[model samples]
Structure formats: C-alpha cells, structure tokens
Target: MPNNKIGGHYSQAYDEELQQAVDRLVDMGGLVLQQLRDSMAAFTTADVVLAKQVKKGDRQVNSFEVDIDEHCLDILARRQPAATDLRLVLSVLKSINDVERIGDQAKRIAKTLLKDEQGSRPSAEQLAELNGMSAKVQLMLQHALLAFQQIDADKALNVLREDKAIDDDYSRIMQQSLSAMMHDSQQISVSLQISNVAKALERVGDHSRNICQHAIFLSKGRNVAHLNDDELQQIVEKKRD
Candidate 1:
C-alpha cells in the first residue's frame, strides 16, 4: 500500500530541494574523507601546513553538520513524513555525528604529527601499508554514505566486509611498531606516535563498520554486525539453496 498520509508536505517543487539536502550531506561526507586522507598525508610527510589545513577543515565540517541538522529539522517540521520517509531523515540526522567525529579523529592525528620534533616520515613500507588501510576505510565510508542514500544493501554489506581487512592491516602495523619500539630505546617517541596513529586508523575503520551497520538497519532492517563473515556467508548460501 502506498503511503498517502503526508501532512503539510511541500509540493513537488520541493523535491529538488530535498535532493539537494541529501547531496549536501554526501558532500560533507566527502570533505571528511579528504580530511582523513590528508591528515595521514600530513603525518607521513611531516607537513605542518597540511596539518593546519586539516584543522581549518575541521571547523568547516562542523558547519556542515549544523547546516544539515537544520535542514533535516526543517523537513521534519514541515513535511511530517512518516514511515521510510521519516526513517531516512532520522538516520541521516544520526549518521552525521559519526562522520563529524571521524573528522575530529583526523584532526587529532594531524595535531599529533605536527608536534613531531624530527619531522620524519614513517618508514616507506609502513607508510604504504597505512596508506592502503586509509584508502580502504575512506572508500568504505564513501560507499556506506552512497548506500544509505540509494538504499543499496549490497553496497552496505561490502562496507561491512571491508572492515576486517582494515583491522588486519592495522594489526600488522601495530606489531611492526611494537617490534620497533622494543628494539630501540631511542625510537620510543616515534614508535609511540606511530602506534597511536595506527590505533586511530583502526578507530576510523570501526566507525566505517558502524556506518554500514546503520545503513543496513535503516535500509533493510537487518542487523548485519551480529553475524561473523562465515556465519553470514552460510546464511546467504542457505537462502540461495
């Protein structure tokens, strides 16, 4: 049955405005993604100017949060959309906080790197690995946001699966940093910064997982996180069988 109970809804003329709002939210997500990537770049290159740019970007992303919140509230107050329509508004309202905090984590990473006295880069191999992990998490975030907007469960599931790979990558980074720390007393400070950055990347991976989880919940009413990959694969196999 089609929902026909819309109250005080804007006419068809407002469809474009509503879509623009969603686009702006996605744009906000994009900005955060770039910040995360650039933060890592700043840390890896010991570029204080890059870190400063990231800090500046933090303020801008916060403004996006505020603007999106106001627009969502306006939609709610005026349209009073119910059911899935209401759900979309509320889920976005909730998800933006996670996105904003992800930006904050990037800011923290930038600040930490800016404090480095030696201005050294992380080892080439280690930096490459970290870059790979960062790319994965960033892509997952982008896919999750797109999935939310498009109600694409398959894309959401892919984002969920990608988290494990990010975790595995971070684990290796941790082990390597820990080994480096244990071997050289003089390297203690650098090792500490490296370990913390790895942990922050791991945290961002967790947030990506959370975003995908909510995407599944909002779009399909599925709680995908409760199942392990093997268990989930089995569930899918059985359904196909």
Candidate 2:
C-alpha cells in the first residue's frame, strides 16, 4: 500500500514515515482483534478479572488512533503526498477510526458481561451462538485488515460478502434469545445482555465493512462509500469490465 511516487520526490525519510504509519495501523488492528478475543473469552467464562482487563485495554486502542492520526497529519503537511500516496494516508486515517470503534464495541461487550455478577448468565446454547457470531465478526475484521494492508480490492469485496452471513447470524441469535426470554421471566436480564452482545458483534461487522470500504477506495480511487451490496458488487463488476 506504500506509494513511492509522489511528484517524483522519493525521500527516504518520507518513505519510512509512511511505512511506519502503516505499521502502526496494523499494530492497532491486531490490538483490537485481541481485545475482541479477550472480551468474548471473558464473557463466556464469566471471568471478572479478564473482563476488567479488556475494559482497561481500551485506552491503548484509543491511544493508537490518536498517534496514527497525528502522524498522518504530519505527513500531509510536510510531504504533501499526492495520488496513491495521498489515498493511502486518507484510507489509513479513516480505517483507524473504525478499528478504534471496534475496540469500543468489544469493551462494551465486556462491560455488559460484567454488569451483573449475581444475576443468571446466558445458557450454553446462547453462549455458543454468541461465540459463533464473534468468530464470524473476528474473521471479517481479520480479512478486512489484511485487505487494507495489501490494498487488495478483491479481498475487501470478499469481506463485504462475509458481512451478510454475520448479519444473518445476528438476527438468528436475537430471535432465539427473545424466544427464551418469553418462556421464562427470570431470563429477561441475561437475554437482554446476550442481545446487546449480539448487537455489538453486528456493529463490529459494520466497522469491519467500513475498513474494507476504505481499502477499496485506496485501491481503486473510486469512493465506494455508503453503497449497498448490489451496488458495491456492480462497482466491482464495472471495474472488472
């Protein structure tokens, strides 16, 4: 994703700076992925300690967003990057915001899990559904970040396709949880918590899609923001044509 041609001025310092920015972005992505994993594990195990740690780790994710944005701004001001280089920086800036929000969503899941220690927890079947949803979301983010790193538009589109499955899973989880709550009045609080977690997982998929959208923008320079599935597929088809 590093563009070497910026008005033909290929300073070593500029190249290093740009590369470092991308490295930070990758690091940030990895950190959020870990946060998601830890948060889900904490919830499933009902480990208050791990949940607390996940909540505390959100600060590091926030820091990475701030640092990366500053570096991008510095490059824009000093290097005045153009063409692909400019696109790279802009995409990184936008994608990092999504990554940070993913971390926040993970943190929210952890907080919800830890909200009530004395109350009943989710049933095993519910946890399995939640874990499945989390796995899909985690994979989506993983692919999105890889696509971002490689500036691979096809990979980004594939991530978009995966989002639909996750959405379906989220809807199924919500339905199951709601049905369980209706059967047992005591299950209301725990069911609500699971619903919130499912919603957070769905939002994570959304943020991952946003990252992939930025990747597409970086690769094709065709601002595919806010487009639906069919529309995005049409754009890809047009590019292929």
Candidate 3:
C-alpha cells in the first residue's frame, strides 16, 4: 500500500518486509559509523574508557550483521525477489559485510591503543595529519551510508572517488612514522603502533569504498566494483542522460 518506487508488489506485506530490511541496514550503518568515530577519538586522546567502549560495541555490530543476514536470507527464500528487488537484497547483503569489517577495523585501532605501553605519542604534526585523514574517511563512510539509504548512484560515485585521497594520506603517514623510527630508536615502539593504526584506518577507507560500490550496484543494477573512476563516471553519467 505504500506509494514508493520500491512498492507495487501484489502483497503489501512483502513491500513492508523489504522496507524494514532496508531500515535495519541503515540503522546498522549508523552504529558502525559511531564505532569508528569512538575508536579514532580513543586512539588520538588515549582515552582507555572510550577504547574499551569501542571494543564492547563490536559485539553489537556483529550481532546486527548476523540478524540482518538472516532477514535477507529469509526474504530471498520467501519472496524470491526479482529485478530491482533482487538487486536491493543482494546489495544489502554485500554492504552489511563491509560494514561489519569496518567495525572490525575500528576494533583493531582500539586494540592498538589498549596494547600501547609506550608513553610517547605521535608528534603534533603527525597527529594533525592523522586527524585530517580520519576526518576524510569518516566523511566518506557517512556519505556512503547516505547514498545507500537513498540509493543515489551519484553520491556513491563521489564516495568511491574519495578513496584515493585516503590512500595518499595513509602512505604519507607511513612515511612519516618510518622516518621518526629511523631518527630515534627509542621511538620505534610508538612508531610501530602508529603504523598499525594507520593501516587500520586505511582498511576502514577501503571498506567504506566497498559499501559505496554496493550502493551503486543497488541503484544502477550493475557491479561497478572493478571499474576505474573514469569508467564508473561514464556509467553513472550515461544513466543520467
């Protein structure tokens, strides 16, 4: 009975079921995004309490993934969705896996903070660079979730393009951390921890990009995961025209 693009099923119950699954997926995305933010804050500020909270939150994120996966499987078995509905189900299934992995990456960062015994922190300049990189990837994750909620291919494409900047930031941070280790042997432990955090953040960016690719697939009904930026742009633009 709902008047929407995804509606029109002969059974109104089927329409509601699909919408509920989407709503749950969006809720899961919000929780994962918050986990990432909390983990970054804990790492940067050395807040043990927040870091512990992030670790505890990972369990909840995992639960959501399992629940959603079951719901999607139920839909597939019962509804046998076709066309756009099939794409929606498949995209949700793929995106939730990426979302769960993002949560794991956040947990990895939290563990790095908890395991660090060295009192030394990154230099102010390096911390600033890390903060900048964190903000970029956080924005990317947020936008990717929004794109999925709306099924907006253009927004998803933009999120996909931003991954390169995160990659560059990761490379620069690795170089700086290595240089610090070389200059002061005593700083090696802390530098290694910083490198690990950077690696986790880099992986978060990758998972966020994967979610965006799933969003594009949902909207366009085509897998853009392997397409380069230029190729993806052409496809999205062609859809617009």
TM-score of each: 0.85, 0.94, 0.94
Error of 1 at 115 (Å): 1.8
Query: Candidate 1: minimum summed lDDT over ten consecutive residues — where?
Result: 1-10
- Superposed Cα deviation of residue 215, candidate 3 (Å): 1.2
Show the colliding residue pairs in model 1: none
Q: lDDT scores for all predictions?
A: 0.76, 0.89, 0.87
Give the Cα RMSD of candidate 3. Answer: 2.1
lDDT of 1 by residue, 32-88 (tens): 999998999898778889999998899999999999999889988987867666766
Per residue, candidate 2 scores C-alpha lDDT tens digits across 146-177 of 88887788889989999999999998989988
Question: How far off is model 1, as Cα RMSD?
Answer: 4.6
Better of 1 and 2 by lDDT: 2
Name model 1 segments beyond 4 Å from true.
1-10, 117-121, 222-241
Q: For each candidate, how many residue pairs have backbone atoms clashing (under 3 Å)?
A: 0, 0, 0
